[model samples]
Target: MHRVKSDLLSAHIGSKPSKTWRAICDGIDVLKQGLIKRIGDGATTLIWACNWIPRTGIFRPIASKVPEPPVLVSELIDHTSMTWKAELVRNCFFDFDSDVILQIPLSMRKQEDFWAWHHETNGLFTVCSAYRMLVETKKNREDYFGSCGNCSDVQRIQKEWKHLWRMKMPSKIKVFCWRLAHNSLPTGSVLKNKNLANTANCKICGAEEDTWIHSLLQCNISKCVWALMDEDLLDLLASLRFSDPKYWVSYICCNIPQADGIRILVTCWAIWYARRKAIHEGIFKSPFSIMIMINRLIEEFEFVQGIDFKEKDLYQEKSRTHNWIAPQNGLSKINTDAAIDRTGTKGVVAAVCRNDQGGFIAASAMVIPHITDPETLEAMACLEALAFAEDCGIRSFVVALDCLNVVKNIREMP
Candidate 1:
């Protein structure tokens, strides 16, 4: 690791360096661009140089410049308590950076500062995160996307992308939708444009061009899937057509409820999968069968998620969980649970607090944008539950976590 930092990250390039060495050196900036400072003791990290602020754009503070004002991150820390000095933070930085800094949870144990891959929640780097980081970095290039057309006009389309990303579904389905929005799906017209195919017409509908919208949302086969899943949305968006798939998605997303949107996204993915199967595996199924499969898939996902959302009083799913036991008198009990995607890349954390008599007190839920493990999520839920309990002025409370590992770790902690 030291060699890597020295040789690849900080070393000066020589006039006679090998091609492989030069390549590694050249890629250092890209690697460094994704690395963020995970403030532990904060003694080693420069506040101006390190990517510490957890925002979408630049991680460095707008108030501070690199290597000029030489400020250590430790200056922002309250050494007595291992927490951020809130007043100092607010005084030193602008509102946006201060808010971001204060929201970053700190460990009770003050450890050494370290570099973590910003893209992953676990602070560990992965090839997948690296690839995504590269793609996002490239988006800044003017010619990378060829033409953005009108960003203002497509903001709604981008919001649909955000909503699609947040939906509780398989990551592959979300990625498929993303590619579909970018009009990069290998439909007949796209393939033809790329010179990979001779014809641009839809194989099923005989349309002039098989665009992403037509292939995934409009063809007779897709229409049948939607009619089975949601005939109203089918009719509402039946005439929806755009030269760009993004506009069609934006219109549909704006018109439908998010629940129906998930169904449509999943159905599109299934339709694409079925098309591949028909072509490659020589298998064919009726639209009803495809819809049935999609329905089952959605039901299973919702059934799992229903444990957190559907209950009127929360935790009423007797089949999945044990019966709820109220806390002792004058005390409150908090229950926390989190749901993660299939890849564990993100999670939704929820905590519900109730009085000793089982009446609700306060409840909160938040999205963990990215996560490496469910244990961390469960632990975070516990923390949020505790914080919520404190905010509600509950002096005596107990947090009930389903994660045995986190519970055991808490018990073993000194």
Candidate 2:
């Protein structure tokens, strides 16, 4: 978010070895290069320096041959009718740039100019789209776009993140994969490096240093667990590069079967859990027993969460029939809605208040930056509705919400 950038982007990353801090700062730089201004009122965008024109690869118009002072995008607009000044636009820039500018549709509502990701048609920025833009640009690494060093390594890392998150596994296991990729797991060597442990050997095996690979895949317990897993899964793991945990994840996403992937991930999680339990509680379960428990856990989780296709469709059909109803007599109702842009990490929320007879009393809408989730936006909408009601001098009012979780929390609040 631009607001977030204002706060942290300027902080000096002094001689420090912090992955999280460096990531935040680097991400801010990426955001700056990726974001383009959407043409709205165009009052805030500069003509020569800003990236507003999406169709023109560079997102900027060529400079007029005749020297001119700084120009705002608003200057070219025919403000009285809320349209572009066609003749002026043609005269000011080259035909290529002029055509693209003319093709851009003007908003009748006269919305303010705002930043959006040009890579996405919907004006929302996503990591996937950004990654594609970076990797697809084969030339001009330092000039126009794209990253350095062939971009294959960059592509592989991004692919790993995407595949790990996309796999049908529990979120905890996915987070574990993230930790594994970052090498953040508290392996014996990692602990000793931080002076948290006196020795670097595994607490369970004690035969090798507790590096991620040694503790996760090569230790006696890990080897036993892997041995108990399906033969096909073990073979798939062996076929891929095991030099790095991240490489294994990327290859699995690309080459392995979905069911096999889930099985492998869940088994790895179980192995890690057993190791922790062995160190803390001094309880070590047999590899055969652990494999059985892992299978049961996987089956139970799938059975509980996987909805039937026909039933899901029928439920959706039933939900579609629930229409809006008028509030009780002498009471006002406030209906609130929100559109979330998960990629952009922001959203817009709007609320409409009406009388019992469906007569519109008031309405309010605003762009909310740095908001990523539905529940938080819906909760904020409810807050806004209450404020709107108070301002309208309406005390007996019912707030209608679309989020069931927020409603339940409100009902259960003491």
Candidate 3:
């Protein structure tokens, strides 16, 4: 049986009279040798015997299809050389009629030919069919993979996929690049690369070199602003013995006590605002001006929250020393004033106790705002004075107010 199988197999392989058939026979011989190595001599012989083929089927297909056989068939022959190539084309031609390859019409025979050639050359037909099966499994997620607008629009999802593949981005930067590409960041509008012509020099300093990082921090003008801010902040930080920016920010935020976090935020925001003004508006102001602007911004932020920095600092100092008190005679002179400005609107209430020489012994100011009515403002002022007195360890003190309505309100209180 083994001898008969080998004779029949050789005859069938040789009778085909084609290079493809010869190559297939060579592959089978290699496979048989591999099987012999694994399964031993008798098992290999049995395998060959079970796998033999007749010569009839092999020659009939080509002989019936072609009028005459070639002298020597080439292994590098094109697809047209195959007897079944026309039948394969016909099957794919009708397959396209079923509305497959939906984007490309069936009338595009050239495109169909290119696709078939690609499949055959790259051996991707099976892989693509498997991918189609996986895609069909995700039919529920079809909406996400749909076109941007109406199906009639010329926009193709395939083009976007091809572009994305060509980008070859690292996984870490991919999402960030996607957001940037989609114009989704807060700075996205300002961060445009219009053209090579539009981006010649730094707009602020007229420097020939201009880049994102340069415009942000490294440019001469930006560096000057940062240097001045760093100097002041570094001085304050040195006094606190914190050298690093992170440590300085943390120290100021934690130790400064009142509205320190808000102050830090305002300071940073002011610095960026100044840089933007310089770049966009071409306003090259002094570093001192920027610092002043930061101070004003901080004041504005505090004012909106009904507070003042200077008065707050003084009050905190007095609160720490236990010196915000009335006179020993149970009489306190309260001076109330309101500081109203575009940046801030706050009412100040100060309690003072003078010595025999008319020098101030104890004084305190309460800074609070959002006062709509004059009477309520004065009452709040007196209350602030009394609270200061109580905080300074003074239990009994006479409260004085310039407003008669405030005086009347305090007297009428049970």
Q: Score each candidate by Cα lDDT.
A: 0.73, 0.74, 0.41
Best by lDDT: 2
Candidate 3 regions exceeding 4 Å error are 1-197, 206-213, 230-272, 275-282, 306-414
Q: Write the number of the candidate with greater lDDT, choosing between 1 and 3.
A: 1
lDDT of 1 by residue, 1-414 (tens): 213445445775566777877777777767787888887888998888778876566888888422344389888877887667777776777786776777565554547877777776556677788887778567745544677544532334455677667667778887887788788888898899999999999876789988877777778887777777545657656666576766666654555555666666778889998877775686977898998888788888778765222223221234576778998888889999988766755677899988899898889997764353567778878877877877788889888888887887677544
Clashing pairs in 3: none
Q: Using Cα atoms with residue i matched to residue i, what is each candidate's TM-score against the true structure?
A: 0.48, 0.43, 0.24
Give the per-residue lDDT of model 2 (tens digit) for 24-101: 777877776677888788999999888888652477886684467339988887778666887888788888777667
Q: Which residue pairs clash within candidate 1?
A: none
Q: Report, for all candidates in order, the number of backbone clashes.
A: 0, 0, 0
What residue runs in model 2 are displaced by over 4 Å at the alpha carbon?
1-116, 119-121, 124-159, 305-414
Model 1 poorest ten-residue lDDT run? 307-316
Residue 382 in model 3: lDDT:
61
Could you tell me the TM-score of candidate 3? 0.24
| Model 3, span 1-414: residue lDDT tens | 112256433535644356766676765553332121111111122211332111111111122123332221121112242111233223333332212111111110111111121111121234454444346435524744674332321124333434433332233233433333343322312333544354456666676655433443456655665566546443553365432333333344334534443444454445456666765697766768877876776666566656555454322434334344444553444445333334433344456645333455477665443223345455556655656666676555455556775566455544
